[model samples]
Target: MSKYDLIIRNGNIVTAETIIQGDIAIKDGKIAETSAGQSLKAIAKSEINADGLHIFPGLIDTHVHFNEPGRTEWEGLETGSRSLAGGGVTTFIDMPLNSTPPAINKKNLALKKAAAEKNSLVHARFWGGLVPENINDLKDLFEDGVLGFKAFMSPSGITDFNHVDDVTIFKGMNEIARLGSLLAVHAESTVICDQLAQEKIAEGKTSARDFVESRPIISEIEAVRRIISYAEATGCKLHIVHASSRKVVEVINEAKLRGVDVTVETCPHYLSLTIKDLEQKGGVAKCCPPLREENEVEGLWNAVANGEIDVIASDHSPAPPHMKEIQDGDYFKAWGGISGAQSTLNVMLTEGYVKRALPLEKIVQLTATNPAKLFGLFPNKGTISVGSDADLAIVNLNESFELKREDLFYRHQHSPYVGKTFNGKIITTLINGELVFKNGDFKKRAQETV
Candidate 1:
């Protein structure tokens, strides 16, 4: 009989604590033990020689739009999860918009879970939508195991997922606080965006750059300040999703100083690419809380390094060719999203680690540990300790690869990072003791759980 189910040997195991040269032992889909500098005497059913590789906890991207049950053609669970796994993400928290019937109620939540179970290649946790009608449904959804709740202060791109006003936000925050669940917000004020957009339209400014200019950094900063004040008043644990401006970061930091329970996340796109990229890439580079100037990008990196930003997620919202319309390349009419689920790690590694000289431990904390801890999925999903789920990513830090849209695992063959080079590579991904990806191929069908 095999002494263990699997053993990953001769790898540099990197964790939030420290890096160690060790062999990881797995049994029944859990980490059994980790032995440093000693050959395992026990026989094992399988072994992977991970020589010269850096093993780290698999990434947990807490923000992604899988567009299932209604918008499958844009990006479905199967393609989205595959993209995540390909990027070395073992788990993700799916946002509750863009789908036909967003996960607002129990019925919608059930539909979303069913679709994910059938198609997802990774473990997925759902975020219940916060809307006027769903106020009564929040408890049930939280009881049903949703990671948290997500709301937009501005009009969500989809009409079905309506925006929440200050009244709804206050009520929802109170309820979320009662349940001890986090409330994640898309923090652009609708009234401000509407006024600015209308003014820009009247001025005959209808281009990608115009769109960006209309949604100024002040919009994000003001909305963030409002949310922080509300959170302080209501005592709600708040998470600002995809914060894109320096002012927002400052506000969040100040709120924390005053004893508010708030956290913030910024996407890889915000840290790596600036608004200037939008000029050349047009619609493909567009995103909500649109990318900012180079100086703002620098400030965001400083925040990440200085421990102001809590997490780094991919905000992986993908759209079909018709929505993006790369051929016509009209920014004003194109959908606002960037597809980079499969390049999150490499992009961050290239920019955050190599260029900015951020410590590898900080990268792990932001990408894996912090998200898992913030969303209440920690100890199980984020760490590489004994008795945890054996989810790991073996990365080759010295490897270099240029991102090509054609090379992405997403259904849509479009990416803003296309043609950009990356310094690191995810060589293998393991989920629950099973090698899901290795040598640029999936070893088994991904398993999705509720």
Candidate 2:
């Protein structure tokens, strides 16, 4: 019998702190040893000669909409997780909307999990919704092992999953704080968005530019300000999700400076695409809190470099083809989403690490470590340390690929980044010692533990 089940040798292992030339040994589906500057000499049943590749901890996307149970046609667990595995993601936190019945309480959470258990190719966790109807169920939901609660300050688009008002949020924040759970907000002001959208609709100005103008920067910043105040008062750990504006990040950073228990995440679409892409691509690129201008994109990049942004998630909300209104080319009538889950890592690598020279450590922090720590999955899921789940991705930094529609695993097969070129490639992905994906092909079913 072999001393270990698998050994990955002669690769550069990256962690949140540093990167080192190392070999990793896996035993019983856990990382047994990470030997730095030396190869593991232990006998193994299988060995991969990973020389010259960058071995990163498998990415944990903190936000995604798989839309299971009620909205699988939009994006189901199986196809969604396969896409994630192909992108080198081993774990993801599913949001509480889009899915029918929404994950508002223990029963709905169980229903979502049942669907996930049947189709998920990766480890998955759920987030409970903080809608007005579910304010009384927050405690039960948290105790049910939801990583956190998700709230939309503006309309969530799905009729069943309505957004929370100020009163509902104030009460929900207190409940979540009492339960020691985090609250992640889609922080766009409802009043501002509704008013502007109505005005634009009445004026017959429903173009991409009109949609962008409807949700001004102040809408996001104003909601961030309100959420920060509530978090401060209630002592809840607050996370602002998918912020697209530099001003929103500025508000979050200033709050952190003042001892507010807050963090912020930006999505790959926001960092990679600008209003130009939105104008050109039309509905496929349209998303809530629409993509900002080129200058704001530059500002967001600067914030990432300066450590003002805590995490970078996919926020991979996808809709059916008709929902995007690709035929009509009507931005206002289209469902707002971006199918970029499989492209998040590559976008960051190309735009941040390669072009802008962001350190590998920072990329790891944004993609894996910060999200893991925030959601209570750290040390187990986010690091390449001993005893952690053997979840990793072997990346060939020298290789490049241009994304295409056929390459996407999304059910809709539409993405804003379809034609973009990326520098780094996920050559292989391992989840819990199983080679789930290699060389652009799936090898096995994802080990769905948790």
Candidate 3:
């Protein structure tokens, strides 16, 4: 009988710090050993020859809205995890919004967990919502094992999950700090965005360009500034999510230098697409704190290369075809989200590593390692080292493919990257030593409990 359950050999294993050509032995869902250029004596139930490919630690997406329970039509845990698996993601944390009741308290958390338990194909975690009305729910939700809390300074677009004010932010942050939990914010000033949006709508300008103009860079930066101050004052570990502006990056970097406990994340859309894509693609490319010009995109990329931006998540929020307003072509009326969980790792591999010459190690840090550390899943889910969970993404960097609607696994099956080609492709994904995805097919397993 084989001592090991499975062994993956001859692949270049990418870790947070280095790459090693090795064979990994897995037993009972954890990596038992990784031998570099040497064969292990233990036989295995299965062996995979992974020559000429890269074995990366499965990605951890810290931001996604798999609107479940209440709004599964927009995106459900089942399809969401399928999309994430296609992107080489092994674990994800769903946001509180977009879901029907929003995960604000014990009841809502239970509801979302029930939905996820029935349908999720990958390991799942959650972020509790922080709104003006839910200030008291922080400690209870944190104790309930939510990874963190997500608050919005600007309008969250859902009536149930309202944007928080300064007072509520202070109260919630104090509670979160006391409990040793992190708070991630959608840092955009509601006043600035609301005023600009109304002014543009009054001008009868509802084009995509006008939408970008409505959420000016100042709106985002100002909210970041306020949140940072509140975090510092309340002694909360703060995280700025979907940071799109270079100015926001600069501010966060300065704050970090000053010893503020903060980190920031950018999305693939900001790094790969720009305002031009918005103008051309219309509602599909529209997002809050809208995509900036080419220079800003380049600056954000530089920040990623420099280690200033800590994480890269898809912020994968999806809506129905009609919600995108694809037919009306009105950015103001469209839902402000991008269905991109499946394209995060591919885009980063193409633009960050292949074209920009960023090291594979850095990509691993941005896409997997840092997020794992930030969200309290490190050492287990984000590294390929010994004793880690045997979750991996095997990719062929030499291959490339154009993203089409048929390639999408999300419920809506639409994305702005529909026609764009990416350099790397995820050939297989292993979750907990199970071959869940391979060669564009998903082998659905029973839902995993946390």
Candidate 4:
């Protein structure tokens, strides 16, 4: 006889393989058994009836900026974790740059971890920054339990976190490869983007449209090519983040076939929004490696559907309202980020599943399984099998609702998704067998803030 802490009955469990209708039993914060028959007649002290809902393995978001320590004013770790939980994410990996001290060394990483310990509501890992000054510290940071390292091939928006040149990237990649960790890059050529931005601003053509043009697909394509070559030469595992172009996906696929250890990630915005949305919504729609044309959007969706793209993350970088809402419409001065932490899964449901018939298994791979395996958290965090943590997101795929500012859990409720409608609403979320969130809870949090 097995002891049970919680039992979820009759849910269609979505996994990387397929969806199965079964009952799951949890004990000691881990899954104990799943039954499709009368294997276990005993009931747990707690139970959830999910007869018509979909139970999915918890999502792992590998790219996010909580901006703790130094930039808590922008978005604190507490609010950020709440946002992740509300979005049905059970685990998240925070980027290094937005916080003060940047997590480039042991002491800074310790500071960031300490803050997360006190504030984070779910599992939180971190990515160390790979900069010119910290090549010597890579060992210490990796030993400190950083999942991997992140480098910007172009100017990172933070003042102190400078972008890496080829020499710096090469050196960092070699060291990282030797340590057997991955290096993720924000791959947009600084030379192309910076030069064009200067020209655009100089000519006073600084609208969001001009910003998009200044950072054309060529900038991203050139940088992706350069970084992939570096990774191939150094044998470093490379990951390209927020890839927004059809051409970039084609090159990454070629690199993969040529046996370069590379993986590509495209954000939900790339699959859903286009330059037209940016033109209509203004700065809130602004982000680096700016949104592509409609055809490019379809291409990214195609890549996802074809399994060419490996992961889909929110890249949930947020800023204050004043930073995003500029009075003069000087788009260049506005923050180049989208408050997207809570709406990524929603977008995928609306655009990827309800609209395009993206297989549920494929969605699970992009959102959960691939990330867990990529970062060495698989089997423990990514699946719903025995001996795994009982992290689950149960959703009602039948319901549809329009998003609003008051439904957000961010410190600032100003996402560009406020007016968008989405299907597949999260019904309940569990982390380590404990109920953490339910539908309509975000509205309560949002009201309390007011």
On the 0 to 100 scale, the lDDT of residue 445 in model 2 is: 64
**Model 4: per-residue lDDT, tens digit, 1-450?**
436889999899899998888899999889999987334576788889999999999999999999998999999888888888888888899999899889999999999888887788778899999998999999999999999999999889898898998999999999999999999999998999999999999998988788899999999999999999999899999999999987899999999999999998989888889888888887788999898899999988888888899999999999998888755767888888988988778898889999999988888999999999999999998888999989898999999998888988899988878899999899888888888788756321111100
lDDT of 3 by residue, 1-450 (tens): 888999999899999899988899999899999998776777899999899999999999999999998898998999999999998999999999989899999889999988888898888899999988887888889888899999988788899999888888899999999999999999888898899889998988888788888898888889999988887798899999999977899999999988999999999999999999988887778888788999999999889888889999999989988888755556888888988999999999999899999999999999899989988788998999888999999999999999999999999988999999999999999998999999889998655676
Off by over 4 Å in 1: 326-330, 446-448
Instruction: Write down the TM-score for model 3.
Output: 0.98
Model 3, global lDDT: 0.90
Which 10 successive residues of model 3 have the least lDDT summed? 322-331
Alpha carbon lDDT at 185, candidate 4: 97
Per-model TM-score versus the true fold: 0.97, 0.98, 0.98, 0.97
Give candidate 3's error at residue 205 in angstroms.
1.7
Model-by-model lDDT, in order?
A: 0.87, 0.90, 0.90, 0.89
Going through the candidates in the order shown, the clash numbers are 0, 0, 1, 0
Report the alpha-carbon TM-score of model 1 versus the true structure. 0.97
